[model samples]
Target: MARTRLLFACLALATPLVPATATAAPLPASGLVLSVRQEMGTFSTTQLSCEPAGGLHKNAKEACAGLAPVEGDFTKMSPGDAMCTMELNPTKATLRGKWRGKKVDFQEVFSNPCVMHVNTGKVFEF
Candidate 1:
């Protein structure tokens, strides 16, 4: 009886507790994996989170905030309205993460860092 009680207690402890006032729709998971290859030929990988404000990103909070609006879609983050210079600078980016329990895989190439920064905001600033 004691062993059974202990097992039950352990199982209870392991269970995640949902808030009583949770939103009607489930929110996305708060994690991201980003890879960026800059125009200067340097590469960097960043991890980010929205809730905890933690990650490898130079501006973790701002990066996560920037990511939240686009719902983890790199294609959506691209700003077509940006008026960038004619320079041939290029940057490659990849992003993989979970949002609303769905898998996201995105890859993109920016014509220049100016375009990248204008469009992507703080997401790839690191």
Candidate 2:
């Protein structure tokens, strides 16, 4: 009788209060996965780790394809009307697009697994 009660209690406690799948969507872009995101005067990229593909130098080309970014003007236009483009190679990542007739460039790092880093005017390591 005691074993049965304990088992039932354990099962009740194990029940999930909320569904596990209710979390936000995973970041669309990943290492070497080139993605574009734009807002007002700035465009940014999703930082991805290149470790899973056997390191950056070896798999840089393949990883670059997974990087995804979203582009749009938050105040002026819809997402479809914005223009954003990225060029990433084994060496650097470059972003170019027009926001309300102004140019915006954004960059980020994918090299280390410690933390995400972003910069402008230079190609970052992945």
Candidate 3:
């Protein structure tokens, strides 16, 4: 009788931890927060939300359009038609957040700000 009572108590304690439904919580449509850091240590950040295209980014609409072709895959972005110098002023860009309800994390380093812009276009233009 004591073992049965203990088992019931343990089961009661563990029940709440289980989800009532199999479906997970819904995710936001699309969003991403990005940052860029120069070799000199200065950095800038911006937020981008797609679909309706609104955020703190100065070129949110263009950025969203740039991301659309690549489906938010930064590495697949087409290089812009910009002539960059061979200057080696390293810069790092990072993004973290969600895209189309899926989590995303990305990072990359470029030879310079100009190169960064050439590679990522408006997505990192902030």
Candidate 4:
């Protein structure tokens, strides 16, 4: 009975030392934010930060890698021939964020999702 009482006292004292609310560390500096809009008007968003890429993008790693070479310049990216149908479908993509510490804002329209995927690499494959 004495040991149980002592144990209860210890737990009671320690409980007060613990915080009722816990806090999480702040999010790291986000380097990039990308938005993709398909021809049908549906859209998706993603983010890439400092080094590790994240968010809802299908190929965050590949997208980030593709962005690095162009430093976020949409025009500089090569639009490879994606062997898509001759349809004139269009898709638009936009990005606003920092790249290697420099502010970046980019927007471009591709012939179609297939063309965009092949030309833009994974940057628009969300």
The digit string of per-residue lDDT tens for model 2 on 55-108 reads 223334333322222331111211123233343322223333332234444444
For model 2, give the 10-residue run with minimal summed lDDT.
Answer: 113-122
RMSD to truth, every model: 11.7, 20.0, 13.6, 16.1
lDDT string, candidate 4, 98-120, tens digits: 66667778888877778777778
Ranking by TM-score: 3, 4, 1, 2
TM-score of decoy 4: 0.67
lDDT of 3: 0.77
Stretches of candidate 4 exceeding 4 Å from the true structure: 1-30
lDDT of 3 by residue, 28-85 (tens): 3777877788996676776777876777789999998998888888878989798999
Better of 2 and 3 by lDDT: 3
Clashes of 4: 1
Candidate 3, which ten residues in sequence have the lowest lDDT sum? 9-18
- TM-score for every candidate vs. truth? 0.66, 0.18, 0.76, 0.67
Model 3, position 96: C-alpha lDDT score = 68
- Between candidates 3 and 4, the lDDT winner: 3
